[model samples]
Target: MTHTRRDVFLGLGAVGLLGACANGVGGRGGATIDARVDATLAQLYRDYPATRQLADKSAGLLVMPLVTEAGLGFGGGGGNGALRIGGATVDYYNMVKASGGLQIGVQQYSHVLFFMTDDALQTFRRSGGFAAGAGIAYATPQKGEALAAETTTSLAPVIAVIFGQSGLRVGATLEGVKYTRIIP
Candidate 1:
């Protein structure tokens, strides 16, 4: 009986170790990752240069941090993100399939969502529409790209995401991450 108990304990210990490294564990490591995210954001902005300005210009900035999920063959496109505006950081999650702009890789970085128009912001905030169609503009930096740029052609609102952005420059296919409005 003692031996069996010891084995069980050992198994649990292994699981605990695995959880620490894995995403969504929400334990000490998860908290650490969040802190790291903040620091990384600082670095990203510093390296990229235009990131902070874009965030500041947006009607609201939604930050999706360290989403560590496996995308088997389909949608792992969206995960939980935070919406920051008026000094409030609201928690949110994304549930989208890419149609136009994205990369096909395991992305584990935070996303900064930029809303370049008032209508998109208003719609996102008031009409409760976080889904694409009404208003919003976004762009994601590639996994290696240092900078992502957008030239807004539509006054109707746009959401262009610059995905797979690391400190490197690699272009990703256009696959939009779906973002649903999080009820505050």
Candidate 2:
């Protein structure tokens, strides 16, 4: 068999596309998403009781039940989630990220963003897309550790808690996650 550079590139592209599909990328509807959101929140409350305080203090929450990320020097991730206001799912959202760095492996995790202020939640919904920025506070769950949301931390406009991690990926960072409201 003979192959050219173009063929090699095309082959890589196909593999990447297949990998994304294998991650279960589409066809999630309202009922399915809401069920997952409910389960995810229950698990979070069970696993990290301290997070309950964070949730209680927030005006809204964006719950991403599963985010699957895979990388081989270049990386990408996609996940579907629900945005809740006043304890009801007001909208659906999809998160996607792309990055290039010295990274390899695959991981799956869940994350929730707490909008502490009505303004923050309003801004997020009004924007076409929202990106996690430096001003946001992060509370990564750890085994046998209590996520203490001090008064100052709770006062932050946006708070993020990442937990329920599985797979071989070394680390997960939210630097490039971009959230877009979706019909699902």
Candidate 3:
């Protein structure tokens, strides 16, 4: 395909506009993020009651209230969240991701990471920026269905529950997502 400078600028401009539309970006502040986190958790527990058990068993939970993602050819996403231990907020974090491929869409979703083991929670807390890797297990539940927190998931150090997705995008995965602690 032939490339023009105009095409490049338009793509970049579109991405910038998408970033602005994302939730919890552009200095929304700690209180705003906390509110969203609480609401997200409430919705999660309501949708999948089984997750409450997981939350209780988890060493810590990182709740991302909303992540906004969009792409034409290249894409990126960002969101703010809170880390909770024993039902209390301990820290705030921001999640970000970037990708380039044959993709085009915009989507919004919420995800929570369950640190099943103290080691996993410590590893995440100690890191300057933590990226999701192979060690993490994903549990995506369909609407009105229970999360299958089986023996395998119990043994996994970290479990991720992704839900409340809405948009033109097809799927959501944390494969390349990175989490960093933020003051806000």
Best by lDDT: 3
Residue 146's lDDT within candidate 2 is 87
Candidate-wise lDDT, in order: 0.48, 0.79, 0.83
For model 1, the stretches where C-alpha displacement exceeds 4 angstroms are 1-37, 68-73, 94-105, 127-129, 133-176, 181-184
lDDT of 1 by residue, 66-102 (tens): 4432221222344445556643555444444332223
Point out the worst 10-residue segment of candidate 1 by lDDT: 68-77
lDDT of 2 by residue, 1-184 (tens): 3445654554355336634663323565888889889999999999988888888878899999988777655567778889998899999998887654455577789999999889999999999999877768887868667887666354579998899999885543334879999885
Model 2 segments beyond 4 Å from truth? 1-28, 151-155, 171-175
RMSD of every candidate to native, in Å, equals: 10.4, 4.7, 2.9
lDDT of 3 by residue, 103-144 (tens): 568888899999999999999999999999779888889999
TM match of model 3 to true structure = 0.87
Candidate 1, residue 87: lDDT: 36
* Worst 10 contiguous positions by lDDT, candidate 2: 17-26
Give candidate 2's whole-model lDDT. Answer: 0.79
